[model samples]
Target: MSLVRVAVIGIGNMGAAHARTLVAGEVPGAELVAVCDVRQEMESWVSSNLPASVTYWQDAEQMMSSGTIDAVIIATPHYDHPEKAIQAFRDGLHVMIEKPAGVYTKQVRKMNEAAAASGKVFSMMYNQRTNPLYIKLRDLIASGELGEIRRTNWIITNWYRSQSYYDSGGWRATWAGEGGGVLINQDPHQLDLWQWTIGMMPVRMRAFCSFGKYRNIEVEDDVTAYVEYENGATGVFVTTTGEAPGTNRFEVNGDRGKIVIEDGQLTFWRLREPEPEFNQRFTGGFGQPECWKCEVPISGVETGHPGLIRNWIDAILNGTPLIAPGEEGIHGLTLSNAMLLSTWTDNWVDLPIDEDLFYEHLQQRIASSNTKKDKAGSSSQPADLSQTFK
Candidate 1:
């Protein structure tokens, strides 16, 4: 495979950015053969910005069949992800789906099934996994240096959304357009981080979520969750869009002191080399615990999604291993679904969320939502929406 023919669906901010990267030749062995979106105007934009040979369409099906495209990048709204990816797979095209795999688990699982049946490369855009720091954290945790991890907390409050940010797209905050708030748009990193770092799934979950607390949105603007893993390791997650000058900190504690990643820095507190028999001989209250910051050797490439994107392209063209396989895409989404279910049920929901029930509940939410400007021909008078909460 000399080059992978690519079609980018959805020409929104991220989609357009991806198109630019391909057009600029950031992805070698990758060519922007076509671009698609429901909006007809997007075709013209791609025509002007992308390669002259690249075709543009308002229909994804036509683009897939007509262009002889070998791969697709689905950047559509969250709810539309599964259907588009499934179609691409059926057409025998490899896929690189944008974050969260799917807003829901059943959809992501369907994609995995499609990929298996088609025997094509399937990858998710969990580019954060390529980050050097996260890669290092994963290695450290797996090394058991953290020793029987006891507690973990990640208060990702740095995701601050403004009125203009919400107003930028009608699909931005509504239930029908997107599935959820901070969990969907802002916390893909944290959600992926949760699974990657803990290396396990929750046995139970309870979450309290708020809608329109700081701003007027149909879905949650804030959420605090409690999670219990099967091994009895507990985690508390807090995220909100209302805070200014917020924090991004992940703390993991175990029998072996702790490791903290805060504000672009990583720190580890190593408990004194090993418990001495003499310490026990000294009696209970006579001695105190002591520790030092361990100088652990750093590992992994200093990189982010660009590195992941490069890998995705290479894996399809050159048969390299994917950093984020399509099979694992469902975990983060399942975690998100369980959190949403916990909030909805007001109980500690168990692992493996009932998909049929989740989709049904989600359907009802989509029906009741007031976000009028869905990409699928829904209209929103921005001025009218501007005063919707005012």
Candidate 2:
């Protein structure tokens, strides 16, 4: 294919944004041939917003079999992500799924397996990976310039949401619908980056998750999780939609030095000598390894969602490598699931989590969930996506 023909499977906030980007010719090598949404209200949205040449479908299966597109961008609900992607892979179409992969790992595992068997390009919309700041951090750690990672801590509570935000989407913030809370929704990017930058996953996690703490919802609105990695590294991930004037700070401390990312700037406190060596050789009492505060320069605009979409399209058309492989998406979800599982079991949860146990717990929640589907409306608020990316 000279140009990858792409169809968006959900016309929700994020999906609509993707469609608009494709229609505006932003992603050079891709074409938005069709947009699909189950909501009847979206028919008018398609007519008023998108080009007349672009087709609209209420059914995704029909769109997949119609052969009008070579790939699909699945932006449906969390539960629908894996199911739709698996079907798309079977139909021999490349797939791009939105974040968090899926609500649970068991279903997502099957989706990954199907993707592997189909030999189709599968990518995740981990737009944050395209940010230059995160890219530099990952490089610094991978290149061993920072030495072995010793600790990771991220306090990303700036994803504050109003009660109306939860009330806007019926499927949101409910066990039977969206499955989880801030961890699954607003914190996926950070959760993904926490491990991606350090190139490691925690061996175990113990989390405290507050359900309906801030919002009038059935799911968790606050959380504080502590984790330990296999290499003796420790981490703390704290997030909530409850606090106002919140903070977004990420710190990674290694043997050589430490790096901090906050206020849209990256700063590194470089040690003159390795801490271990400095500690061993220092004779003076209360001495430190002389540190120099350096501002790590980060240049280039973040490509965000469009950039990831472009990467997926390029990989499909020209055999280019994907920036955010769909398979690695499980790593972030694993962390989130472990956090929930830890809270559910009231104990520490190990890595490579018990998928069956998690599924069983999730089913119990779903069965007991009093969450009403379509509680408000299917459409999301008019998103000022610019405010959301940081």
Candidate 3:
């Protein structure tokens, strides 16, 4: 099989992982053509560990213009996704960007428009859908066995990040740098899952968020949001980076029964048969509701981030459908912006994220945000498997 030439922008922790996967050939039909980063030493740092065949550049525009790449992965800071990936589009390369599509909805829209104009496969790094347990749960819901999803709630306080974690990089936990906190970073997975599972976006939302309670960042470190869907289904999303050993639980209650996913496992107590309301011809006060008798075990192909990279390469090379399209990324970003705007203004923020008003507010926050970089320029990388993967 022919390999797809791949180039990557941003040589931070996650970007390095993407490049290594391509170099090791774990992502079938993918080759690491080049790497780029803003840091002057980042190119050499990546070159030292990669095969000598792979090129390196300090500027993405220069690297893409060098006519050596087929597709590009944009993994830079929050605001850079639009400009860099749009440039990639202009260079006739397919693009895969990280989450939020930059901190503002307008930027995401602009990128989406560019993707439309280029007619190339445009994707986002929403890797959570690849997780097997969540996919299985989505299946159960789609089967109509869940029976009218009434309420969905998630308390994702398990993402307890220390001050050091926030201070580890310059483009982290600041409005100017990263935009928002838990909701923007740690909770994007949950937010994506929320919309993906429900198959709908909220009509309106009201939220309350805490700014810099536990970390030394300039944006929110905690958030509580209430959302209402078009079908009248309601949801509560509570997330925080401040709480230690908190809770990571998703409770989905329907007219039929309830399903819970916690600690990386999915458990559903399916009713033995149908509930009493289905055969409600007679009085229903004489007996209790029937219940199911088995625990569903979830299994998925453990590809981590490489799965997404492989999918994008296949889409660009062989005309496979994209797993996470650029348009879907905007929904979560709009929801997030609405939540933040609601909290900041002390009132409910309506749906579709009043783009102009929200942008104005975000500009103020970003302008005033002080990005305090950590002395430690990097975080520990995940164990490399190039020896085995190769």
Candidate with maximal lDDT: 2
Q: Report, for every candidate in turn, its global Cα lDDT versus the true structure.
A: 0.78, 0.87, 0.78
Q: Report the CA-based lDDT of candidate 1 relative to the real structure.
A: 0.78
| Most accurate candidate by TM-score | 2
Clash pairs detected, candidate 1 = none
Model 1, 32-127: lDDT tens digits are 888777766665666677778988787788777674789988877776677888888888898887776777888788888988998899888887
TM-score for all predictions?
A: 0.91, 0.95, 0.91
TM-score, candidate 3, is 0.91
Off by over 4 Å in 2: 372-390
Task: Pull out the clashing pairs in model 2.
Answer: none
Clash counts for all predictions: 0, 0, 0
Per-residue lDDT over 129-182 for candidate 3, one digit per residue giving the tens place of the 0 to 100 score: 788878888888888777778889999898888887766566677877677888
Model 3 alpha-carbon drift over 4 Å, by segment: 272-288, 372-390
Which candidate would rank higher by lDDT, 2 or 3? 2
Error of 3 at 324 (Å): 1.7
lDDT of 1 at 96: 84
